[model samples]
Target chain A: MSGIRVSLRGKSFPDASGNGTRQVLGELGFVAERGEFVAILGPSGCGKTTLLNLIAGLDAAYEGEIALDAAAGNAAPDIGYVFQNPRLLPWRTVFENVCLVLNAPAGATALVEKFLAEAGLTEFRDAYPEKLSLGQRRRVAIVRAFAIAPDLLLMDEPFVSLDGPTAERLRAMLLEIWNACPTTVLFVTHDLDEAIALADRVLVLSESPASIVADVPIAVPRQERMAPAVLEEFRKRLRQPEKV
Target chain B: MFHLHAIWPRLASFFLFLLLWQLGAMALESRLLPLPEAVFAVLRDGFQSGEIPHHIGITLGRVAASFVLAMAIGSAIGIAMGRSRLLDRLFDAWLVLFLNVPALVVILLAYVWFGLIEAAAILAVAVNKIPNVAVTLREGSRALDRDYLEMAHSFRLGSLRTFRHVVLPQLSPYFLASARSGLALIWKIVLVVELLGRSDGVGFQLHLYFQLFDVASILAYTLAFVAVVLVIEAVCFRPLDRRALRWRR
Candidate 1:
């Protein structure tokens, strides 16, 4: 699979206050190579989610070009997205919810079962979303994203609002899954520690009318990325006034 | 098992109602207020002779046909209006006009324009109901969760799948709400339609009994029809409602 190129020169929207248009992205550009994990770190309301929307094609009103290079022998590169919420259909069972995105081709059911087992939701396959806990539901969302075997995956603070222990467990689970089946990922978060722990490269974003302020590459090895000292160093660097 | 426990209170209330009715009949001592026993006797004889069942069957059929027509057309129009600003603007005035017009006026006009035919009867009942369903479903469509829709879009679930999985479940509650209220409104309008022009059904039977001042038979037919409606509410709608909303837990 080839890398995905997103070159957004100018993307803006009309301000909700009925004022003039607000520019969310100014000359923003990046390329995520195949199997690369990139984290977009920014403060809240910094149009981080808007950038994901543009790549996912959910919002087409933005200016500039956002293109996905098709993989070899594929019509277009398949994209998966995990929103701020689990967003499962309450009426559907956990298994059926994941199956909602799968075409009924040969071996589809097996793939669904494999993903469910990976997420430790095999017992709750028939359970509805309302029956699952918040953390469990988030796990279901992650499994659903991976079940499609997407070439490019996008996540918008998928672990937000979760308790510390639960969020840590899910982050580890996400890394385990990604290690098994590497894909181009663009994870958005406001936490420096989370970005450092998850991504190979971290792109820090400015406040609203956002622009890429700093593109920092994590040099620490994968296993030591979460060490207290390494995390402290990244935190100290992110706290610097120049980066903000 | 719990259902049996729930039934006793309802049974107690029903018996209490009968006792009060019996007292009213005894106090009035007038032919106008027949005893509950007399109404029951009429019900027994009418059922044995198959006369009451025929009227009920006809009325129920008319109600079913009109209800289906109104709901199908109303939901379609409602969704269109909710999705498109132009369609909502175009139909908003029409919906208001229909809603405000008296049900009697519509029935009368339908009969006068189309004559006393089955189609006219059904049309009048359905027309009275469509506006309400449309308004309700439009609100449901507007309140749909946009985040779920965006999820569907990101996953590239096609239009049919999106409607089935994302759209329909959110709308089911509104559909049920409209249906329950619509059924209540429609049965009454059906009776009125039958009373005015129809030759069969419980409404026509009531009209006949009215001329003779046969209060017992009138009450009997009315009580029987109410029983059927209650049975529908209990047997059909309750289970469907529970199934549709079971995810709320």
Candidate 2:
């Protein structure tokens, strides 16, 4: 089991002019249960990505305790992160990109092939990132993140700008993989529909210097989340509360 | 792959350059400027006598030694300085100073301090090239995409693998840029070192030919060395460049 607990007092970034500091996140604390999918939904430029980065232990200048515990007794949970962009090494092939993170290559070949096929990227397994289309590249990024079977998977708007149909398909694929692995996923997105559709719990956040505005739970079953009626109900109930 | 259509323009360019040189020589009609054919004939004779071949071999060895030394040490220091703020602040001033230092002064000092040995000569050439390589690679390291590095770190791809897989590939274009210019700069510096101190090499032969006012031999030696450099660029560097950058396509 993997879980993330963060209690941050405040976080600020130096302004572009370099003479002043702008506070980005003000008192924020949340606990993600083991094997839970928590979607952090906020408006654009609401310090959503910064929150994910801090939870992923990428930024250490914040004032608070962030604890990641693996119930399996590992020292620290092995994290798998998917950025908004693919960020693949252009010089490396798709197979090589996944293999580099495996660390133990002897038994990883079969696992890599399985993940590629699962993501429907087996045909593009040897292709470089530049050779793939934007949608295909995002698929590869998801595949790379899932192939490692990470204890904690943090995704920062992995499907932000993709066309709706492709994003829908990718979301289905992500659910299939996460269902099989059951890792703790902290997904950050601006789309409330996406958050409700994918996350077991949705943490609604305000604009910059962000703090939680609501802690939403997806009461509908997973299979029914995409149904028009259920989504309509969620939109009316969730949006009316925050007027977002 | 070898398109005949692409070659004609290149061949014509070469022909135009030679025609210009021939016209200039004829217009001058001086002992200083030899005809292209006369220089070629001198080159043939020099090879027949084995003197030019021996000197060319010595110069090639010196150039290779200095090139390897500079690339290794410079890349190491460059990556270190690029990654660490402390290291960069400590060595940045030294790097700038070395970059501005004259190659002539460096060669003179090396010879004086190290007694004009072969080691001193090679050291002088490498010292001249290191700061340039370091500067180029430092920019490459600085421009490394943080997203890819973050992916590596999140996946727990240890530091060694991160450097090999993430850092090195991004640094390659910069590495190649420095190497191409480094070879050219080292080629010029090595000759100067040999001319100033060494009893052998093409530079020494050129010095000897100067005493006799044999401008034809000097021109011939220059043409042969240029051909060598061109051959090396075509046979080694071009292929390596294409392979390294094949992914860009």
Candidate 3:
């Protein structure tokens, strides 16, 4: 099983127009148990992306400790990230893009085919990412992340800006993959409804220099998450996390 | 058959060029402005005797050597400079200096320092061409999209794989651009290097013929060598560039 222990004390960047530093993340700590799905819900510019960067080890300049516990001991956890944009290597085809996430690209190509077929992208395997529609590209990105059976998966508003029907379909596919893989996931989004629909627990954060304001566990059952009445009940509980 | 649309214009352009040259030659009626037929005859004889082919081969060899040397060294420096702020700051002045320095001065410097040897000729042409390649590739590296790099980093793709897949493909356009311009620059520089120093290349032959004022032979060598370089461009580089960046819209 995969788990994470992140304790970020602070992180900052140079302000654009001033000679001062602007704090982005501060005094934030959280734990994701093995096989758990946790979503970080915050407003825009609340350092949610910055938090993901630190946890993913993309930014190692943070002030505090962020440790990952993979199923395999004494090795760095394999982290799969689904960015807000698909971010596929434009030159490589869809299949190659997924295969690139594997440690052994040549030998593990069968895994790529399997994932593509499961995601209904087998026919577009050889097509370049530029040729795919937004929904199709998002599907490829999800498939790439789950194909590796990563120790921890980080997704940053992966379904942002898609139409209603398209976003719903991709979210369904994402849940299916996560259920099968059962890896620790840290999903970041500004949309509260999305968090309520997806995560086992939603960790709410405050404005810039963000810290956890509320940690609300979704009381709705997984099968009934989409039911309008259940979602309404959950929304009332998170009605205002800013004062929590 | 489908390429006929593209091929027809090129064929017409060539004939139009020849017709204009013929008309000029007839109007001039001087020993220097020889007829196309006379130039072709000289070219045919030179080929039959094998001296022109020998000279052509030598010039092409120098061009290939210097082109490869400059590109390899230049691309490395360019990439390094692009990635590191310190390297860019340190090398920026040197790049501008070399770029401004005249090619003839570089050739002369090479001859003086390294002597009139084969290596010196190649080195002169190479140093003259390196700065341009380095500049192009440096811009390419600077313009590299962070989104793809972050993707590579988050996936923990090793340095080698990251470079081969994410980095190289992004730089393909820059590489192709450098190579195309590099080939053009190296051809002219190699000819000058041969003319200035070496005794067995097209440039040297041109020099030898100039002393005797053999206009027909000079025109024939110039035209024939231009044809060969054109063929290399069309047959080698253009297709490779198209294939390398086939995914681009």
Candidate 4:
């Protein structure tokens, strides 16, 4: 199967209030040859969300052209985004919320069930957003995004609010889902441990006027992902500040 | 369902207030303020002779017709205004004008234009109710989440299907709230219209009572209307609201 790629050309980052515009990313480029999971780690308010928004088409007030690699006359690659918050419509039951994403391509019940079960939300499918605990709501959001089966999945700090155990479980679940679908994922997080746990390559960003400071590729084998020694090594490497 | 045990204190308070009213009537020896027992007797006789039912049914029918007409037109206009910036801006002045106009003045205008027919009375009440429903629903439609709508668009949901599955469900609470307030306002306006126009409904009966200085009969008709309003609250509005917001609990 042919590979899918995306490029952002000439996108200027907005300046901080009253500060002069500084180039954040200059013709910043990266290519995922085939199926690759890339994690973008950055300091708070360093344009991580801005980058994701530009990619998601949620904001078009930017100077850039983003291109998709797809056959002529074919549909553009579908993108599913998991926001920092669950952002579930509080009024809908979990089942109804997931079913909403399926309105485009018919017969998406199986996809909803698959992701719900993967995310351990099978029993809570009928629950509303307010009734579920925080972790459960986060899981619902994750599964809802995954259910869409977008060619590109963008997750923005999806587990930032969860407890350690829940975050670990979700990170494992995310990897499993990624393995199952092999969708190109752009996972953005502030936690180094989370980046190490899931991403095939970790892209670190500068403090502000953010640019890719380092792109650290994962060296550990998938089989030894959960092993304690491998994780310790990953943690140590993430702590060392890169040459600015 | 009655929760009688929970409301016993309030019921006792009501009885005490009535007792005080009865005592005051006896002390004053006035025909204008009848004793509670005398009003109860008048209510019993009115109900037994079916006068209460006849008046109540006429009042209820008028209110129902006007309320239904108002809700239909108001909701349609509200959805349009909420959905379209152009329509909202174009009709905003008209909506503001009608909302501020006094109900009695509108009824008077209807009387002059339509000559005190049942249609005029109903139209007057409907005119009073329409702006309320429209304004509430317009705000509701505006407050709907754009993300949910985008999700719907991406799915390519048909307009009717989107309305049923997404838009309607979100707007249900607003609709229910509008219904409750609109019903109360419509009933009150309908009574006034009936009193000023043709000779039927509780309002006309009360007007007749006023001519004869029959305070007891006026209170009886008022109690009957109050009972019907209570019945509507219990049987219609509360149940529908509970069902619409069932997801909350």
Task: Please tell me which predicted candidate would have the highest DockQ against the true structure.
Answer: 3
Cα deviation of A65 in candidate 4 (Å)?
2.2
Task: Give one digit per residue, the lDDT tens place, for model 4 in B134-192.
Answer: 99999999988877675455444558767987799899988998999998889899889
Looking at model 4 chain B, report the run of 10 residues with the lowest lDDT sum: B149-158
Chain A TM-scores for all candidates read 0.95, 0.96, 0.95, 0.85
| Residue A192, candidate 3: alpha-carbon lDDT | 77
Error of 4 at A174 (Å): 1.5
> Model 2: how large is the Cα RMSD against the reference?
2.0
Give the least accurate 10-residue stretch of model 2 chain A, judged by summed lDDT: A235-244
Ranking by lDDT: 1, 3, 2, 4
Model 3 residue B41 CA deviation in Å: 0.5
List clashing residue pairs in candidate 2.
none
TM-score of 3: 0.97
What candidate 1 gets wrong by more than 4 Å, as runs, is A228-241, B1-4
Alpha carbon lDDT of residue B178, candidate 2? 95
CA RMSD per model (angstroms): 1.8, 2.0, 1.5, 3.9
Cα lDDT tens digits, model 1, A1-244, are: 4467877777888879988888888878888888889999988998999999999998998767887788889897778898888999989999999988886635687888987898889999999999999999999999898888898999999999999999999999999999998889999999888999999988888887787878888888878987888888887776563453
Q: Model 3, stretches more than 4 Å misplaced?
A: none
Error of 4 at B106 (Å): 1.1
lDDT (Cα, tens digit) per residue for candidate 4, span A1-244: 1133444444554468756665554444566544678888888877787777777766676665665564345476667778787777777899888887664546788778878887888888888889998888878877777777666777889889788988888778777877887777888998887788788888887765565767789877776766888888876666665443
The candidate that achieves the highest lDDT relative to the unseen native structure: 1
Better of 1 and 2 by DockQ: 1
Return whichever of 2 and 4 wins on TM-score: 2
- Deviation of model 3 at B148, angstroms: 0.7
